[model samples]
Target: MLWETSPNSTCLHAQREAFIADVNRIQADAELANARAQLRLPSSRSLVASTKEGKFVAMTSPARLAVSVLVISGCRRHEPAPPLIRPVQTTVIRYGTAGEPVSLSGLVQAQNQTSLAFRIGGRLIDRRVSVGDTVSPGQLVARIESQDAKNTLSSAEADLASAQATLVQARSNEARYRSLLSTDVIPREKYEDAQRQLAAAQSRVAAAMASVRTARDNVGYTDLHSNVAGAVTAKGAEPGEVVQAGQMVLQVAQKGGKDAVFNVPATLMRQSPKPPPVSVALADDPTITAMGHVREVSPQADPATGTYVVKVGLDNPPDTMRLGSTVIGSVTLSPQPVASIPGTALIQIDGKPAVWVVDPATSAVVAQPVNVVRYDSASVIISSGLKNGDVIVTAGVHALRPGQQVKLSPPAT
Candidate 1:
């Protein structure tokens, strides 16, 4: 070091000594902090300068300046890091009585279905209508062999004509016998016999006329006619097939009304006894829809499946709701007070259902046991263990632990 000093050298020397004193004070403070914190810091004793130096110089010594910088750096106090806060999504619970809407797959059917059958047993000669064919009232749907019926009708007519001729002859004979009795030419017993013969002939003619009418009806029965305007949904017998009396030949679905038939699970049917109006729509095309009320429900569950058949009669259904078309029926149950939460929030603890609930005061989560009333695809119906204003964790539930600190994300816009 070199000293180029003129007068006032004493003042410069005093300033240098004061700077050294400040550095020494900082070093003492660092040492005290290390002892109190029990931290194993690097020794700062080596950086302490001697109280006396040999001579005053114009420029400071590099070794002494390095010591001052080290002493200043060591004076900083160490602080512990802040606690970890995990960000999670949460939702508030709101209790309400709105039950979830349930949808069922079903088939569109006629409200009034009729099965056309032959009135008498015979070989089916002709089937004029097939499946999906439309027919009007009194339209000929099918025909059975009618040769026997026609022959019976002809025989009845012949008997009727014979009885009529006999009745005429008996009346003439009775009139002639009465005139003879008046002239005392015939006995009274003979006149009574003629009257009895006339009565017998009249009764026979009436019976024969009845037989003719019956035979004619039998012939007409061979040709099956549609009594209602509808479309043929099915065909039971083909041409040349022998069918019995009252055996179905064709099934017609009446055109005026339609029904949506559904096989509903027993659980759902039990939940809502008097179900509200159902909304029915085509399965393939949703735009075609109709409102319906439950018209009938099967008394017993199906043997194959534990479900009840529900028939919903549609009001003024569209033309597209053809018989046998696939449809979807939705039944909205009446409302009941129940709380709903997202399905992701549910967890199992000790084989029981639970959820992670947030503590507003501490911003921590705890596992809460909840009574689940029902389960939906995306949410759960909670009947107990949750109340209004309770906040629950929705996502990342598996990763969370009891009493874990959390920061809630802002609600979605």
Candidate 2:
């Protein structure tokens, strides 16, 4: 090609060579820049080595290198820790019988308590029984001063006697007057006057008889007697104390049946369809238990306590069961189908009661709304939203999230 080549062709060849040379030069300059950058930057291994030595012998200043190394280490350390799977205790829910038994504190009392008082007012003269004294039917409990009663009775008797004498005389006069009128020995007006006198005398006699009876009754009332076999619980009068009619002088508790009296909430009374059977235990002696049944329930709620007074009659109460002793009554209700779980399993979501339900296949938890029937001391009774064989997170419920994987811990020993 060089042998006798044209000038134009030679010039084109020289231009092509110059273009190739410029491209080579540019490429070489880029490579050199890249090398310089690599030398200035600190590698991971080199930085670690520099940290161990507490100094950097590389082209870069030690301060810059140290800062870069710390930043890189911080990034590596802060890289989001792998999400941890929490281990939680769980329980398998099953449908079973559940009921709320209302327990109440009550006092043991006699079924019949009587307050004895005088039917007539007078000064109390004698008290035959003291508090805690056992008494029998017809036993004298107390007596009022009877001197005034005796005097009144005597006056009534005297008046009755005088009235009887007058009545006898009047009868005799009436017989005589009738005879005289028939025989025409006296005027008709005289006979009529005699009949009127007899009638007035008969009225007086009748009045006197009534007064006598009333006086006798008043005398009898001065003596107070026990109507039932019982023990005296209280005494309101002492000798020489003036008492009013119908004022309570003593309180007697009858000896037969005992009752456990409780003030129960009105809500409990409404919820129970019928009076539930109860078991009573003495607060002082818990070992002493007796069976009982509801005897009475107040129709109206007490305004002060907002409760109803309930009386449970004890069956064959023991001798040791005394009046005024404290007792605890426990009642059991009919069984209902419900799911029972520990209280820890319950959680609230969106201001509503909920529970965490675990998916058996994926071991993940999801919040589920539940109808809570009852909240007991240690457990909760669920009425709806779960069925038999449902696994629930009984523990670690507060630290759970929706659709979070978990591992079931071993059951507690």
> Each candidate's TM vs. the true structure?
0.59, 0.61
Please give the TM-score that candidate 2 achieves against the real structure: 0.61
Tens digits of per-residue lDDT, candidate 1, 256-288, equal: 778899998877786774857899999999999
Task: Summarize candidate 2's per-residue lDDT along 134-167 as a digit string, tens digits.
Answer: 9898988899988888899899989999998998
lDDT of each: 0.83, 0.81
In model 2, residue pairs whose N, Cα or C atoms come closer than 3 Å (at least 3 residues apart or on different chains), thus clashing, are none
Q: Model 1 — which ten-residue stretch has the worst lDDT? A: 48-57
lDDT of 2 at 269: 74
- Give the C-alpha miss distance for residue 275 in model 2, angstroms: 4.1
Highest-TM-score candidate:
2
